[model samples]
Target: MSTAIAATSEIRFVLDHVAQIGHLAQSERFAAASDDVIEAIIEGAATFATEVWAPLNHAGDTVGAKWTEQGVVLPDRYPEAYRAYVEGGWGTIGVPEEHGGQGLPFTLQTAVLELLGTANPGFALCPTLTVGAIEALVHHGTPEQQAKFLPQLATGAWTGTMNLTEPQAGSDVGALRAQAVPRGDGTWSIKGTKIFISFGDHDLADNIVHLVLARTPDAPAGTRGISLFLVPKFRLDKEGHLGAFNDVKVVSIEHKLGLHASPTCVLSFGDNDDCVGELIGPEHGGMRAMFTMMNNARLNVGLQGVQIGEAATRKAVTYALERVQSARSGATDRKPVRIADHPDVRRMLMRMAAQTQAARALVYYAAAQVDRTTLGDAAARERLEILTPLAKAHATDLGNEIASIGVQVHGGMGYVEETGAAQYFRDARITPIYEGTNGIQAADLVGRKLGMGNGSAFASLIADMRETSQTAALTELIDVCDETGRRLAGADADDRLAASYPFLTMLSVAVCGWLMEAQGRAASDDDLWQAKKATTAFYLNQIVPEALGLAAAARASSAELYAVDPALLLA
Candidate 1:
């Protein structure tokens, strides 16, 4: 079968089942948009991703981007593709209609973003950052700020960047030394160097708006003292047009392992006196404002995992079908068979499909939950927050595995640069690292999500899983779900409440399996349902066993990792 047909079949089956579970609407964010509109939006995104974006994948990896005195320059095709993105109304998918956006639900936007990331992640970074900036302005900026900036950002006239990282302040915001001094004219002057700022300086948009995090004098220690500011590349004139040079300068861009199309820049703000910035929210409430964007960004990052895995899996299938190899045992004919006929190859493909599908289920469910929280009853919002970290951490980790498996299935060809599988592998390497590392995500799961409201969130999750299991037709499936749910529910406070990193992988597999079973039953196509069933079987039979070991380790020690020192790990 053709790859498109196969993808359509699989996706149709998955969505058909997923739709049966409940209203899988994108989010309350798009409560105003009709179902037809939403469907159109999704179809458009899929076409663009598979056609427009997919073709550029190798080009981006091969040619990458170049930096010069003017700014970061992308491939020639990038401008036209980006223009298509904006002209198609993609840049404003989820923003409010009042701000020149389509005002779709965040869930639908999540899907669209996934497609964009999958098609060409390097190209997607600029828009992603822009959307986050628009969100921040909408939530916290003064009315003038929103009215002035949101429209341009929505229209793709301006792009956005977040300057939160420094050489020393990557994971720990407390270590930030960037400064925002009061100018007494209401605007502040920001001075600091930001590293690894994606799209920090790019020529794709007319102007770049940076949402910078900096410390003010007399502010308290650590993250609490930080403030957020809007620093633009050029000052705006009375007519609200771009004018005059801003002090922000792109010192250099990183030569990274992957994502060559997107420039990760080292930006120096206020190196000259011209860098004027407007404060966002309260002076000391920058972290809070940043969170408003980070929450959405984190979920978006989770979807990237799903997108990358989906792309890699699709590529693997194409390679497996096209390449003929040795026959399986007992084949009487001398003709070679497709490598897919081999048990190991079949096993690998099955594993990749299952993991990708499971990760999709988890993240999509999270997306639906996020949307429901906005438009549905109060309980859903609480549920979504609880599951958000799970989606981000679990999906990304699975993405890493899927990418690795994709390379493995390609064998030696996957390791070489020519196969294009290596690009997916290299691109996927960063998803788990950004939007908070998987380690941080797990810690969030254990430290915050599990114990919130005296275990009410996780308690609700367990109860819901049990309810689903009770209704399940297959006793074995129900037994697996029930047992895992019970273990989750009955654990002591320490077990439930301790550090979440080590235990996150196990928790994810069980929950993912539970969700997949729900998805399988809800499916409409027999073949798709069968596939879902097989995937669930794999999860239960193979993946869930790892949970027991993880749980055991999690319960055993807080410092077991230290038992083997750095010296021993060196080999």
Candidate 2:
């Protein structure tokens, strides 16, 4: 059989496997969310994303949001689409009960985001930031702050923006200089300029609540001095109504390479000395507070990678099935069969399918980790903390690769806007750049995740690998896992991180490989399972070794990057 047919057949096998896992079933939050409501929500989200959002995706990138002296102006359709989102109650998914949210698990939230991002990445930014803001307040905000903000944010009455990056401090949060001065009346006056704030200024909602990071007068230098504060565009009265303009203004907006419909803004706080803000958490702990939201944002970004990958993969698969090219050896007629029947095309599509599925599985597992930590019974929380960064970084990196391959499969069509593959590629590019950057995530893995409990966390990771590999159902996966685990033993932090990373990558591949097989074995149709089994073998034999190489590198010291000089990086 041709690779295209084999790959599609493989994808069907993978979905069948996923469905049996009961991912779409009503979660523990069902009672609070309402009976049959979760299914309705999923069905509605899937339809809206596929129908409404997908159509505007190309247009959003082409037209983008306009930046002017007045403010940022998005493409015409965003407002209506956002309204539909609110009408569907999507904005309230995964929120707390007291705040009018449905309070669903991260799994449900993951499903929603996957569909939404696949539909439109630019559009997804609005709620992504809103949820991030809601999380910060709910977790670290004072009760008054939570009472004031969560309900509106939960209901999508207003949207939220995360203000972290500044011109001098893109990746380094310690370099931040935004200042917050305490006012005797319990509020603070915040003065800062935040650049690259997503959904910074939008007409999608009544107000934009900014979670700002700033320093205080008596604070220590560096990250230790920074604190998080809430700055709303319009001041809220004691009764929670819109009061007056709070000195927060959009200085300008950025014109970017992708995600045009999502307004990226440069925000100036306290330009007129009237920016009133409320503190979140404690003094000199802004980074700690922000980490919660940042972590969530990273996972969401990873999902975007999957979303774009799936979109591009679906498009490529369609084209491969319908577009007839040059006839090959097996062709009896002068005319070519679908390119999907071509060996090379099948290879490309299979590669795309495998990588995309791996990304999805890794990210979803991470979502499960997070849910276990957040809502799972107490025992699972600690392990979830250790696994979170791996999920976020690996999934996103895979997302970018998957989207890139998606374009390649489309051949020349992927490059052109008309084919829409390029949009997926363009949008997927941002995943590794934002949400704390993939490099930073790796560093976190080394510095914090592995180092936690004096390397006990890493030890636990090894134990998990051992247990996973011991499963007879996952023999191929276990072999990959065992090999990777053996390679990662006795490495320093940086090397361990590097090794662990690719090891994690390999682990994801092996896990998905096994998942595909296990799912294929139970498949109702023999032909589909045969195809799936082939792809599974291909992934294990071919791709799992790349992860092994990373493990080999991880077994090495940081001498590679460190031994090189700053000038040597130059061509």
Candidate 3:
């Protein structure tokens, strides 16, 4: 099996048919993204991801990144990869023309990044975080700030990192203790210790911009007190020239199960009380400003699931075709055939392929809504709020599931690291945990998102789903989704929280089923779209039924959950 699978045709199908990215091109903001241009961009990205990025995956995991006294050192080839990515203008996709980018639709940017990640997820983190940072600054930064930093970041000459987590605060951002004090010279002194910072301190870029969340003197307590700051690894002068050390240091990097080349670092700022940072937004609106970046990362994180699913499913399918094991049960000759010929193997493979494709559909659809929202579509913004969590939670969850099934399909070879099937599993384990726990995503969905527009946004979503749910299986699943949404709305907090995960699965599967059915109807019968049609059918026939079982769990009370004593449960 090849190290990478771009899924180019599949992605373009979603962008063109399901996501309907051509609508973006109709708008002046994305006029440059003509079909021919988009196709060429995707083709070029596929080649870069395949030729430049894919080969780095195994070594990124095996040799990994190192934390030396000098800084974080990547394996020798990693620098060449980063430089190629920068010079190719890969990072500037979707950024405005004025910001020194290609000025394409965000839909295209997402499609291209998905290809890169599908090629090399471990090494892809650097560019991914940088993309998120660019978005944050664009939305919240002052004109001066954008003037100084946006161009370099847009070009990927300098990378970026989000510094929100600390030893004391992981999911609970309110408990953070990072501090920033006015230096009386316009700049502020930021001092904090950040943990679990991805691509935190790397030698790959010329300079790293650390977006830190900290508090100031006499601010209100809890989340309300927090402020967002831009602290660079090296101080920048008026002309954006690199200067002094700025006292930011990478104290250590975590040794992890996977993604070794993407350093998760323990960073200390203002160790000598000289770190200078400029505020990005309002004084006490750190959470609000950070959400700009977090939301971008969340969608991209979900795409990580799509990326891994594509890679894992391709690997599994490749191995199944080659690894001949058993004779056909009904065969008279008793000749050994490829495992792909076996009924059970076919079942697993179809499930993997269908679920993976369903996830890609959801991600692209959500990405399209993002493009529409930018064009002042109110409905799109509301739908995007609801779709973001589903995309992040469900896709990443499927990434883990599909990657595990990839291992299962490989049987004995899947367990051994030498065959490299296990690496996909190990790498996928972090997606659901890192962005925000999928459980948290579920809670947010039920707690706040469902309540948007007094339930009108969700109702609108259901109406859209009903339009595409022509098949009985999809029709039934979407109806369950509507009924379940109403049921959860009226349920008590405990019941809602208890059923959150199951409810998330129920609704997410319903949405995916709708998309697949819709895509299947419009897909051409050529060899290129055969996989799409087959997977769409498999998902509706086999996977859509899972929604029924999930609905029952979603409707179940929170009683049994609270029945067990918390301490005793752990003990």
Candidate 4:
């Protein structure tokens, strides 16, 4: 199996040209992130990812994590790799300085995450969830909570998890039955069974903070009554030192298709009626507080899709260049040639490369918007609200598609587990399902995001996409957006629901086209620019046209969809 390599040059190019990391550095919030410092950080992270993390991917996948009477145990190399990750300050790159971090821009941190995720996503999840946890605490934690948890979490000494799902309530979070009762001592007793908790328990960190969602006795029904709580694996005494167990038990770790190194555990809280938790934010405000972490998590999840696609594309490209096959059809001499020379193979490779590049541009652009929000740009923040779901759903869908194409590029070798192509496919499958399924994302786009601030957010986005360039691709995108916006405006609730997924797809494809055009315009006469231009052409000519079909689908009414009986579906 070929090892996955980070495309440092491509990443640097996107960070500079598309995301405009320099402009972000000029912001008062990011004044410390000079260009040289950013470059050095990216380069250093790339080296660590390629050397320390990539080597453990295969071992982690094969050996997997283990569960025993003691607890969940990761593969041997993971501890050393995680230690190096913390020592290198990779986990603290984007955290605030007040929390014992270097305080770099989130855009730069996102780029670093791309490197780590591409190298090894299983290992990357620990830090990813921790960052989300830290963000939640920063926004909602009390001064005392911040004093006790923020520094350790920001420095990567303690990891975190978001506990939302239950056996009965997977996507329907309102259906959760986890119970929390006031202990009358500035804490609450929480009891529930949470499932599909990633990085729930690991030996790599001293403590694990779980942001749990549960209901109080007198709270209202459904989501509104739910509240967010901070539950640590180990209890802290008055002096803020780790003491006894907190009654958070890891029942078992899942045996999964991919990302075997990442332990997905079913956690049982308060099984012995001794679990204690502290409320975060306001009472009965779990949804709002959790969204703070979930929104950021959704964006990172989208980047995961981009990361896997990039890794798979690299593997496929390498394989095509080395594998020999029949000569070109027109050749008089009967000599073999690299499969990369075949026209069909070239098509497949181009699709993988182009789609991966476009997705990278979208993810980075979204991350930049996040950075802009920190700089106090209200418009940028609004734009992020619209871009979030599109980035998450579109990138993940492309990740799965591109990985399947990657397997096809490798032929029979891709089918066998040893070649590692199948692993990419397996790992990518979870992105769309978790982090709010793509279906939910699409619905959010059409139902909620489109209507934010009387539709000003999406309207401004379309206007910006139109103003970005005058290319034919952008023109097609503009038309699609205009039409979808029109359909959504007059759409009945049911009709809009039916068209939501296709509308999100069209919008995502159009955004990718706009970003590609931007890349082409920014290119110099160098070889990298030349390659960018060619990929842009391929994306515009081949991929952008899907928007027309999706737009048509988005225009379809719900009448036909609902005309079919529910009994027929079961039949």
Candidate 5:
């Protein structure tokens, strides 16, 4: 059986044909990124991912991260793998040129990230957070802050993290109690404990640049009063030299169900009352600044789903081809054949293939829109806003579902960890929960994104989907869009909120269907293209029709949901 995680040809096909990434290369912003250069970069990334990171995935999962008095200790291979990643300049691909980066298109970076996540998601988390931190600083940081942090972060000399969640606040940023007291000097003394801080402490880099959310002493209550702070693990002097410890410590690391190699730390700031931090943006502007990072992280997390699904699908296909099973119903020979020949097995495999490909197309398309925004397309920016939550929620949900099916494909052996199929399922389970839960994403789609410009953005998106083609799936999508628009327009906030999840799900399915159909129409006569066409057909015929039921559920009233008594549910 093949050990390959993803096919390079397929990635190239999607980039060129489905996402139309050439337009990015032609843009003045990314004029230096030619087709040859992009191809070479992708090939190099694939080599590093498959050769270096892929080998450590199982070991990292098994050994996980250990905590001692000193700090969180990762598996031995982690440091070496991360070092290779940095040395190869993988972290600088999408950063701006002024920051000592390669300045490639974000769409290209997204492609490379898919490879990294597939190879080892646990390892991928470190750089993923760093990239988000880089983005936040590039957009919102002061000149001094950018000068001090961007080079190190872009080159992976030091890693980065976002500190948001606290014991009192999980998803509700308004409830956080972290305090930032203004010191006599320009800096502020940060004091608080942050939970679920990914890569908060690690042995992989010289310092960890923590972008934390805290409240100022004179600020108002709730999220409106919060401010963003940049607190490094070690203090830096005027010359950008590392100085004394910043009084930030990791109290412990969480033993999680998956992505165990990535340390989720309980971080205490100013335990010794010496954790000084600089303001990232304006005072009382933390939410907006943090959203810049969170939005980027959300898109990356959504891609995580697609990555894991593709990896799991590859593994399942390989196993099915190797594992011997019963013959077909009208077999003349008594000997058993490969499980791939079985009808039920084929059904599962096709579902996995179609969903994974569809999710990839959806994510890559969104990334292209982000690139378009960089070229000053306001409409593309709005489209990205609407697509963000849908991509995150839908892709991650599919990742979990497809990984579960991968386990089933491996049958009894999949239950045993030695087969490696169980690992994909475990790793994918966290994508939907983190970077804002899928439930929150659904609500954001309904309550926020859909309502943008008095519902014009969503209406325009639906119109674009309708223009793609008039297949049954496309028609269903149009119907759902119209129905959702009507329901949301007529109902109060409560009714719309109740229908949010289903509406998001329905919308995602329709968008995926439209992209797949577009792929089908553009495919050539090549074998891979033919396979893509078949997968697109399967999605439209078998999978996409499910959106109709989702639309129905989304259009339903919230009365039944409210009718159930919470106390009686336990009985």
Candidate 6:
């Protein structure tokens, strides 16, 4: 089966059984997202992703995007494929109706994006960043700003980039030195170097709207003084037509391990003092505005995990079923058989399928909560706040793990670049690093999200998991998660920080386990869902028990960690 086709089958099952998307349709805001409409959308997007996008993945990876003085040039058919994506209205699927979009639920968008990302992640990154830009502009941009940029971004006529990282400052937003000075004509003069800007320069769109984080003159130090600016590559005239260059230059692009088609550019603004920008949020409110984009982005990035995992798993399964090897143990004839006949090979394939499906369930569940909160569900908002970090950190960690497993299942051929298994591994490597590294995600979970709503958010999560859990091991995992969370609250800073990762994994596995059981129980006796049921059993039975060990690691002494001096760890 086509990878996108298989993914659609899995996602459809999740929507029907686990994601609670039907409940979302009950809301008047999402009432138009009828069952038939959603099904059509998924089927159409699958076709588009596989036909228009999938064929380009290998070429995009091999030829990649080339950096030119004028702009970044994508591989063959990249522009036409992107144009087809926009014309198909894929970008407008989840945008609000007021912004010239179709106004579907974001969960649907997430599902569709997963398909596209699976087909060709390097190309899909362009539209993904555009979605985040539309989100930021919708929430934080002024009425004038919205009227000016939202239409273009919502429709993908103009792509967008988030420019926050500088060479000197990585994760510490407080230390950024980029500056935006008021030009006394309603526009600001933005001057600074932003490194690692995805799609910073590309020929895919008419313009690139950069959401830049910078300091304004006379503003306070650190993040308090920071502000967000909407700087475009090309300026518009009085008639709102494309005009001058605006001095937004792509100084250089990175030579990365993967995602070669996605231009990770080092951009220079105001090189000749001609870059004009408009403030996004209030003065010194860059972090707030950026977080509005990022919180949404974190969940979207979570889908990347599903994307790569699904792609890798599908490829690995196909190879396993086709490649012939020695017969199973104790076979009388010892005839050659498909590697899939081996018990250990089957075990690896099962784990990959189960974990990928589980991650999909968890992220889609979070996406459904986002839809609910849009319709004024207060509790859903609290749940979304907690689910964001879990989805971002956990699903991405699985992406890496599953991709690595995909390689191992391929055995020797996996090591060769031609087999393409290695590319997924290289691409999956960045998901956990970017969009707030998994480490930061873990810290957010322990320090902020766990305590949200006066601890009610996490408590409510555990309570809900118990309500849905179908197996004892899952219940036990949830219980351990609860215990670990409580202990960390009373522990020292070092211990709490040290325990963050394991607690994150434990909680993530519990959430996935609970959702898996729910899916399993609700599945039909049909061929497709029968496999879901089997995978769910594997998750609840075998994988869920791994959390028991992780729980102990969660309580490991910070003293043992600090026992090694920082100096010894340095290169």
Would you estimate the TM-scores of all the predictions? 0.91, 0.89, 0.98, 0.98, 0.98, 0.98
lDDT of 5 at 319: 95
* Regions more than 4 Å wrong, model 6: 566-571
Query: 92 in model 1: Cα distance from truth in Å?
Result: 1.8
| Number of backbone-clashing residue pairs for each candidate, in the order shown | 3, 2, 0, 0, 0, 0
User: 125, model 2: CA deviation in Å?
Assistant: 1.3
Clashes of 4: 0
Candidate 4 at residue 63, lDDT? Answer: 92
- Residue 278 CA displacement from its true place in model 3, Å: 0.4
In model 3, the runs with Cα more than 4 Å from the true position are: 567-571
- Over 4 Å off, model 2: 1-36, 468-504, 507-538, 562-571
> lDDT by residue for model 4 over 1-571, one digit each (tens)?
4346567778888999888988987777788888789889888888889989999999888898899878899998798889888878888888888887888888888899999999997888889899899889988899999999988888788898999999999899999999999999989999999999999998898899999999999899999999999999998898888989999999999989888889999999999999999999999999999998998899999999988998999899999999999988799997999999999999999999999999999999999998898888999999999999999999999999999999999999999999889999999999998989999998899888888888889888888888765677668767778778766866888888899988888889888999998888888898767878889989988898767767767888889888989999998
lDDT of 2 by residue, 146-179 (tens): 8888988987878988888899998888898898
Root-mean-square deviation (CA) per prediction: 3.3, 4.0, 1.1, 1.4, 1.1, 1.3
Q: Mind giving the per-residue lDDT tens digits that candidate 6 earns over 1-571? A: 6654346777887886777788888877788889999899999999999899999999888899899977899988988998998789899989999888888899999988998999998888898999999989988999887877888888788999899899999998899998888889889999999999888998888999999999999889888999999998998887677899999999999999998889899999999999999999899998999998888889988999999999999999999999999988999997999999999999999999998998899899999888888888899999999889899999999999999999999999999989999989998989998989999999988898877877899999999988867688888889899989988877888899999999999999999998888888888898868888899999988999987789778999888887888899995
For candidate 3, write residues 1-571 as lDDT tens digits: 5659657888888898878988889999888889899989999999999999899898898999999999999987999999999999999988888888888878889898888988888888888899899999999999988888889999899999999998988899999999999989778999989999999998898999989999998889999999999999998887789998989899999999887779999999988988999998999999999998998999999999999998999999999999999799999988999999999999989989998989999999998998898899999999999999999999999999999999999999999998878988989989999878899999999998888998998899999999867788778888888888888888899999999899888889999998898899988978988888899999998888877888778888899888888999778
Cα lDDT of all candidates, in order?
0.76, 0.72, 0.90, 0.90, 0.90, 0.89
For model 2 the local lDDT of residue 132 reads: 82
Error of 1 at 71 (Å): 0.9
Give me the overall lDDT of model 5.
0.90
Candidate 6 clash total? 0
Q: Candidate 5 residues 1-571, lDDT tens each?
A: 4354567777887888767888788877898788898899889888999999999988889998888888888998789889999999999999999997988888888999999988888889999999999999999999999999999999898999999999988899899999999898889999999999999998989899999999999799999999999999999988999999999999999989999889999999999999999999999999999999999999999999988899999999999999998877798987899999999999999999999998898899898888899899999999999999988999999999999999999999999999989999999999999989999998888778887888888888888888766687668667777778666866788888889888888888888998888888888997768889899899988887877777767877888788989888999
